[model samples]
Target chain A: MAEEMKVIYERPRSWANKVTHYCPGCTHGVAHRLVAELVDEMGLLDKTIAVWPVGCAVLGYEYFTFDSVEAAHGRAPAMATGIKVTNPDNFVFTYQGDGDLASIGMAEIVHAAARGWPITVIFINNGNYGMTGGQMAPTTLLGQKTTTSPLGRTPQTNGFPIRVAEMLAQLDGPAYIARVSLDSPVNIRKAKSAMRKAFNAQVRGIGFSMVECLSTCPTNWKLTPVESMERIRKEVMPYFPLGEFKVAQGVL
Target chain B: MSDKVLMKGAEALAEGAIQAGCRFYFGYPITPQNETPEYMSRRLPEVGGRFVQAESEVASINMVYGAACAGVRVMTSSSSPGISLMQEGISYISGSNVPCVVMNAMRGGPGLGNIAPAQADYFQAVKGGGNGDYKRIVLAPSSIQEGVDLFVDAFELADKYRMVVMVIVDGLIGQMMEPVEFKTKVDVSTLKTPEWATVGRHGRDHANVITSLTLDAAGLEKWNLKLQAKYAQVERSESRIEEYQMDDADYAIIAYGTMARIAKTTVRVARAKGIKLGLLRPITVWPFPAKQLQAYAPKLKGALTVELAYRQLFEDVQLALCGKIPLGWFGRGGGVVPGPQEILAAFEEQFGKGR
Candidate 1:
């Protein structure tokens, strides 16, 4: 008789065996694992409820073994509001992409933040709309080329990308709001830590906690994974600086 | 002991919610229904309940979504325009199968039509008000008393069916103040709730999965079957109707909400002139009290249906008859509530034509 050996980098217990449908080099796969690892670590494996908004991450329900609900396009915050308010005992969080949160869903997220709902939000701002194909996002960089902006995004006809973390940080309700990135190994570690801190904030009922990560999509960006990560480091971080934008005392 | 008070229909619903153990209300002010939230703001705190004025109807319904998940009876109110904005959230609640009340004191609209009473939302309300194949247990209340009692019933139905319950009324009911008796007072402290509530993992089982999506087709179909079964039970156990003056009647009138009360008055007036007319008023808009109407339909010469809107409720009455009896419909829209006098004239015309 033999017993299987335990492993660290093995698949997380809270995430299913479904191979991530994310394009190669898409950091959503990495981001998801980080969240699942934290849920497993904090013993919230049984009680965590994650909301997946309609975007590149709409299929997030398939990846997480923890219970997940898919909200309508731009309605994740509202859906999360329902779940969190009704079951405040469970750790509730929303995983939203750039367009889902910063653009069409701005009303929902802003209002949720203002109310100080005790929930966690992991926002992956990948600069362009991925699922609907390459399109300008609220976080899309100036002069970025996309299907919607063939020539390039111009200031007169198209608006500039939004800095969501810094904007939300100035609000009073969020206990923590940080800008993290996945462009490098050091930043990846920081991103996971920031996510853990946000979930921990929800655990303490401190208020809303959000970490907006600057991620990249190689398939949509028309680049290889290596090139995409490099572009994110050099191009995205210049506008959306990574740091702790706001924090409530004693939340961490 | 029932305590009596005179309150606006909108105000009555708010007070009834408080009495029904509701401690949180989130809503945006809209015409013909602003009193509900305004009252909650003043009264919820008195009862140690929470009342939040959301940024918009979209936010308000979501606020209720949050509060309802916390295991409390919660609600939001808006007129046509605001309610339209809330349709997406209402769909979310239905899909997730959350228990909460949404009061649409309907005003005229395909858009923001007017602040006056209208029954134009009947199709929207009884037909799930949003996407997905589901239905809200729609209760169309006719007066201030029904406004209060219907909300009480709505909460119970919401919890029972585990779906959204709509206290479907209009501006006329929302604004009119009438005497109402509170038959019961809710003490939330005495109630037991599902452990799935998101009140923070305290003394409970693992967090309940309160979502509507099951990506697997078979799983979603199974959930749908369960929901459909629950709705069937409501049709069997909770269907209601009020009949008036049907003895030896030759022609019957089918109506609901304010239109039914108005029809009752019309029947009484027509009775004085010696017309053998009856009234069939539906209480549960979805189950529709169809069998009762069908029973009357075969025996009567004809039936006339009335509503504030053109033809929504009339369709239901017709289906009830299943072509066993002749049916006629007359309604007005755009801020006008049908009066008994006009209805009486239509009844005479309908009766004569059928005879």
Candidate 2:
């Protein structure tokens, strides 16, 4: 008789079966997988409308098996609010990069959160603009060298790095605000859990929710995937601490 | 008999949008068009719709884009400078091939020129303001009644063509009060959702993705070809013009929007003086009633173009007439609106005293 075997793991149902365009060691694929997993686990595949930002994940819509719209650079939050408000019963979310959300789209993100629009945001902060090739971003660490900030970022010129999670947490609108890193297996699982909680806030119609994923851009960082993970632990984490910044009442 | 009520142009235009089944309105405040958002803020909730006062015109147009992608009737209104901020979002919406209505209540501008009425944005509206090879159906309304009436056509054309449809009115029309009637009331419940909307998959076999990005050069060229085809179809079928008193006329004045309304008085005055002057008003400025103007070129001895801005409308008139008739141009910029007598005097100066 043939041996009885069962599949232990496989791709998430909501994940599209296609090769990704992300550079090797980039955590955008990981972030996409987490979102896809949540879409499948929560049975929201059919009811999910994603607003993809104009950055590395600009074509993120192609990697997911759900309705999606592409927003102009930095306008994802506003676009997502438009979608959520008009289609109140549908689940809406925005996937953005640090440059897209924390820099050019600052006003959009702040206002969307302040309006308490019940939408989820998955922000991938890799310290620099990845798509445009290693330019300085609003979240670029101090002393980090980017093409735009070749020598190093300085307070007098380039300004200080923005801590978006802590800043948004101060607002009354957001029901949940959390920051997690994708530097390790344990933190990856934690990031997934935090994303679930953020989605729960929206599912329960509490208010706005966001999960900031401190990710890696190996190509831009000029480091191997392993060294990038280590840098997140020793460097990025000190500046952008990981933890839930806000959790509204009744959110698990 | 249709019930008519005295209404401010901006408020009437807002109510017209509501009547056309536009359930979502996103806008930021600006001069000559503030009443639109104010009216929508109060009236949308009553109609089971949504209204958002965005942080800026940039956000407002993006919100309009999002709602439009959800396959719903949505709109935004702004003045000159504010509309400039919306150009990027408008380009994205057009490139993505979604449907939405945008209103520009023209204010003077080279830069924050003034709050007074002006038509300097003619090139921006009928021509290109945003990036890429895109065209928006621009309807120029000469009166509050016409502005209200065009709102229905604006929304319908937007949906029909799956592109942006802009209704351009000057501050004069936007702020002035006139008797208007709500001629058409579209039942929002009857509006069918388009297949391309990104509202959610629901039970569909595949998800819809709305994007304007085509990275491949050949692929983008093919998309451009498709858009050009659609624009050609619109140009063939949608160009509109009103020929006022042109029969047996020796001279004509070509104008649009508020300028057209003021020029109508010039036509009457010139005819009273037996000058045989008439008016050719382009109702749809883009797709530009060029053919209609050409049809009159053979009969007209001279055509004078008048506007609230310098040489903008005259350029299109010149292109249409193509030097077949003696062309004359007159305009006042920086918020200066020429009176009927001044227009008549300019007409005589350009085309001579009488027929």
Q: How would you class the docking of model 2?
A: high
Clashing pairs in 2: none
Q: What share of the true interface contacts does candidate 2 keep?
A: 0.90
> Candidate 1 on B15-114: residue-level lDDT in tens?
9888887877888878888888899999998997777777778877766766666567888888888878888878877787778988888888778688
lDDT digits (tens) for residues A1-252 of candidate 1: 999988757777777778888988899998998898898888887677777888888878777666666676777787677667556677889999999999888998998898888888999999899999989998888899988998888888898889988888889999999999998888899999999899999999899999998898999899999999999888888989999988999777
Task: Give the Cα error of residue B234 in candidate 2, in Å.
Answer: 0.4
Candidate with top lDDT is 2
Tell me, per candidate, how large a share of the native contacts it keeps: 0.38, 0.90
What TM-score against the true fold does each predicted structure earn?
A: 0.91, 0.99
> How would you encode candidate 2's per-residue C-alpha lDDT over B104-140 as one tens digit per residue?
9999998988999999999999888999999999999
Q: Which stretches of candidate 1 lie over 4 Å from their true place?
A: A1-19, A40-47, A61-68, A83-90, A249-252, B69-71, B195-207, B216-226, B353-355
Residue A94 C-alpha lDDT in model 1: 91
Candidate 2 Cα deviation (angstroms), residue B207: 0.7
Q: Candidate 2: RMSD over Cα atoms?
A: 1.1
Q: Output the lDDT of residue A192, model 2.
A: 95
Residue-wise lDDT of candidate 2 within A54-123, one digit each (tens)? Answer: 8999999999999999999999999998899889888999999999999999999999999987899999
